[model samples]
Target: MLIPLIALAGVLPAPALARGMDEPRASLMVGALLAFAAVLAALALLVQARRLRRRDMQLHARNAHLAAANAELREVTERAEAKARMLDGVLAAMADGILVVDAGLRLAGWNPRFPDYAGVPRRALRIGMPLREVIRLQAEAGEFGMVDPEAETERRMAMFHNGTAPQRLQRERPDGSRLELRRTPLPGGGYVTLYTPILAPAAAAAGDAMQAAFRQEWTSRIPRLTAAAADGDVAEARAVAHALRGVAANAGWTRAAAAMEGIEETAAAGALTQLRLLTAGLPQDPAAWN
Candidate 1:
């Protein structure tokens, strides 16, 4: 409209221009209005562009913060997974049977050896299984002696609830094997029971008991120790040798313990020839250990 008006002013006759405003003055006023309109439009565009740039910056900052938070969460999760794996490995290597119970005496956790040592079938034990059920299974297996099964279960359950159950007790299995049970209260509200297998019956003297227990274990493991040494499996041989040393010391066999210590020290020092020589003399018969 402004451009057309300017054009009309230019084409107007000299008489028409004289009737209204003069040509020079009208042209000057129209030029000023066009320049003002252009300035206002430019100002509006500049304000709009600034608003868009600010919004983009804010979005980028928010995205960066979220990305950092996500990275931190991932790191924490990985660490937690590593710790859990380490705990599982430790549990798998343990020789004793372990059971973790909640405050209500429900099963919470257990190791692989727990079922065999506790004399309960693998299918019978599960997470959240009640202590009563375990006792019932044991009673059915005649683990609590020749008394009435359900009656014995109820008796034991009563003892557990009333805090009358023994913290440590030794019981013989029907197969003539024995298990030593020791219960320890957890820091929070729960219990952890350890079932250690006794290779022989109780004796009047501790030394006699240890000897009876270790003889069978020694007879069984010596062959494996020799085989590992022959196979050049240094790690396997060292593990076997170390376990035998612990067994010897535990059984009160001073000479055997000293001999095993020497073997382990030699193996650690990478003396494979000495390790083989020591394992070669390992006895495969219980009588030799006695």
Candidate 2:
């Protein structure tokens, strides 16, 4: 609409100029002026339209890049959050008591196992409560180690700051449960204390049974074979030592099994005196047989 109006205004000026010229010349000059003006207007409009179109293309490209970057950022954030949730689940499910303390020796975070092992209610745990104070209270109540509380607290603090030594200690609960305590530093100016319960008597008994079986079938055979060698029964001694070697190897006692192998080799070589010497210091108690 505006282009046509501008073209009409240009032609109107040409007619006013034509009044001063002869008829044919006036008509020709008017036509030339009208054509020139129309060409100039069209060129101006073309340049303006090209500039607008280029601006629109640039805007669309910038928006697409921003949308892609935003999607990537959202994906990264979601993955990080998922990992954090997984870590939280793992910590919650752990049997060991875990407590995180800040640089000021104040409790920052803890697992449910903390109160369970400490024999205290969960309400006793709170942020900003001094770690030394908690340790002292628990120790006094026989929840922690037998060491002097003040000295132990100082040692832990020293270990935390130095990073050269491990902050490990032992504690016995009132229920006769033993605990192994260790403290590690967190990345952002804090520390974590982990309390792992020592194996109970029932579990220890089961382990002892397995150990006893191994010893009976292997270690106990050594002395008997040596006695047979002393009695001048080289054949019996060699047979017994060879049997002990197989038993020890099967029980995963590699070093002991190797020793038995060496003894068998010596017996095979008729070195009974060496075998007697090796077994001389072996325990004699019946309980030691196990």
Candidate 3:
């Protein structure tokens, strides 16, 4: 390109020579034209080099941003997986059967205890199965007992869907075991249901009566213990302490049993003052005894 331009300039100077020009003057003019062309070429090269450098910098910045974004995404994914594992651990350790359903009423997950508590066959529950389907299966298996299975299924499904349904309900199984069902709504949506076996009403009543009788017996012994303390009779105090400890143990009052043991040790050691002090701290409430 420079050769062609130089040739054209040379021709233009020939024309100038034909018009009129001395040799020394023509040589000076040609030299000046060549110098000006070199300056323009140098400036053009500098501009192109600057443009390439700027483009390289932009590409480097874009690559760095992409790497950073990928790292952040990986970290977020790992954290989510860890949280899911923690949740599973918690559910597995629970005694009651637990079921988690999504906002669409589809089964999301369940604990291992669910099948046993629901009286459903193992592996019968699957992810994405509708909650109504699980209820229908249970109803057909006589979990709701000899009633219209379809009707019971509809009733259960309605109650579960109804926002106003009771959070807790007690239902009896065909085998005579009672289960306490509790429903809890999730924060984002959907619900978690738990089924826990509970004692029958008659058994619970009997338990209450037994506790009352024991409390009465313990109360009757309190008078004797007081008299023994007043009389400073070590033998009587020791006997009363033993009896109280037995009563507390039977009632499953661990704190009360420990207290009684302390009294017994004092009496055995003949520390009447300490024995009386310990007795003074005894629980007065019958319920506290257990």
Off by over 4 Å in 3: 1-20, 199-290
Q: Which sections of candidate 2 miss by over 4 Å? A: 1-17, 124-133, 136-166, 186-189, 204-290
- lDDT score for candidate 1 against the true structure: 0.78
RMSD of each: 12.8, 19.6, 18.0
Q: Rate the local accuracy (lDDT) of all candidates.
A: 0.78, 0.72, 0.78
Candidate 2 or 1, higher TM-score:
1
Point out the worst 10-residue segment of candidate 3 by lDDT.
1-10
lDDT string, candidate 3, 45-123, tens digits = 7888899999999999999999999999998999688657745654665557898899888999898889988878876
- The true-versus-predicted C-alpha distance at residue 85 of model 1, in Å, is 1.0
Better of 1 and 3 by TM-score: 1
TM-score of model 2 relative to the true fold? 0.54
Q: What's model 3's overall lDDT?
A: 0.78
Count clashing residue pairs per candidate. 0, 0, 0
TM-score for each of the candidates? 0.60, 0.54, 0.59
